[model samples]
Target: MTSTPPTRRREWLAPAGLIALSLVPVLSGAARLTQLSTGATITADNARFFDSPVPIVVHIVGSSVFLVLGALQFAPSLRRRRWHRIAGRVVAPAGLLAALSALWMTIFYEMPASVTGPGLSALRIVLATVMAGAIVAAFLAIRRGDVRTHSAWMTRAYAIGLGAGTQVLTFVPYTLAFGAPGPVLHTVLMAAGWGINLLVAEIVIRRRARAMSARRGRPAPASVVSAPLS
Candidate 1:
């Protein structure tokens, strides 16, 4: 029986951490906070937008589609063929709709104006923009046949897209540690959650690079290369 290499071990760490972290909200019962009766929910007072039937329908459908496609990113075989292409077709449009709907929802929905202040709004817009950009970059990279770049960008994008889960995970520990009440605590936690996801993606990409380099053996230094006789 062969033991896994150190590089493979390192590569597994982030996804394993994310998978475990993703379960915290459900296990801790933190998701209940989002319910209407929880009295801890975030929403805008613009009932026309928050309570609008059309946006809600779009939000549900788009988010569901994005979640399914995002999960497929973790499956290497599924990401390698025509099926991946078909999935991409579905993912791109759905993801865009999800992001747009979410942005709109955030705008119309009121939280503690202190919590949803201009800075927080800006951060949400930035996250949404980055999410959209990542999807576009992933599609373009694949079209150019740069699979490594494609995978890296897509993973980052999907990670950001799945950030609602990360946010919930962050809130539980933060609330426990700080006794959550202040807007500052919530803002800090949300930012930290997105930061953690981005960091995880970066770590995964770097580990993959290291593993590939190890598999190929480090190339001889250019300074050591002898020129052909002129």
Candidate 2:
């Protein structure tokens, strides 16, 4: 059998598909908020959430806004435009709120007695803290006129934020195959979500850096330079 080759359209299509898939978790989480607000009975897996729903609600809503709006920033057609500049202004606050909300839930929410292991909790804490730090670093880099550094940092932070979206892919199959995972297994799955996204982001960042470097190193065109002397 022959393997199919990639094309430019496919390259653009891939991000569109990924952006759609990533929205699944955000939309699902948003739907759940109505249930929470109405005091409807959530499943056993989510019972503990009722004890403290505000943080979770804030996280989901803020993250939903960040994820949806942030996806647009990755579009090459948009990144160099004025719209990107305006979007960045809004994306920062949305991302920061999401990260801070996750931190609050990790630090303060009581885990369900059924799955009280520190595995997921610890992972959330670290990711939230790093994401928040990255957001601030991006801001500082931009303020210093280091657009490249700012973009790279923002990319990394967005990757970390994508972890929650990736969790559905990582956990659902295993949970279906063998029932809900224990603490260690759950931790491993969640870590994979972050690892996979961060790895991809690093690759893109390096590629962009190389491209930018080449552009800067290119010699001026002879036509543009013209004759030095009359």
Q: Could you estimate the TM-score for every candidate?
A: 0.69, 0.83
For model 2, residues 4-82, the per-residue Cα lDDT tens digits are: 5565355456457557866876878867787887888777767757877878888887888788788888777678789
lDDT of 2 at 181: 86
TM-score of 2: 0.83
Q: After superposition on all CA atoms, how large is the RMSD of candidate 2?
A: 9.3
Clashes of each: 4, 0
Report clash pairs, candidate 1.
43-109, 43-110, 44-109, 44-110
| Candidate 1 RMSD to the correct structure | 8.4
Local lDDT at 20 for model 1? 57
Off by over 4 Å in 1: 1-50, 108-118, 212-230
Residue by residue across 1-230, what tens digits does model 1's lDDT show?
99987875765554455555545433332333234234443455433433454664575567666766556646555565679878878977787787777677667755445445336777887787777777777788778986666667767776776676788778877678767647666677788778887787777666655665577798432211221101
Candidate maximizing lDDT? 2
Lowest summed lDDT across 10 adjacent residues in model 2 is found at 221-230
Against the true structure, candidate 1 reaches a TM-score of 0.69
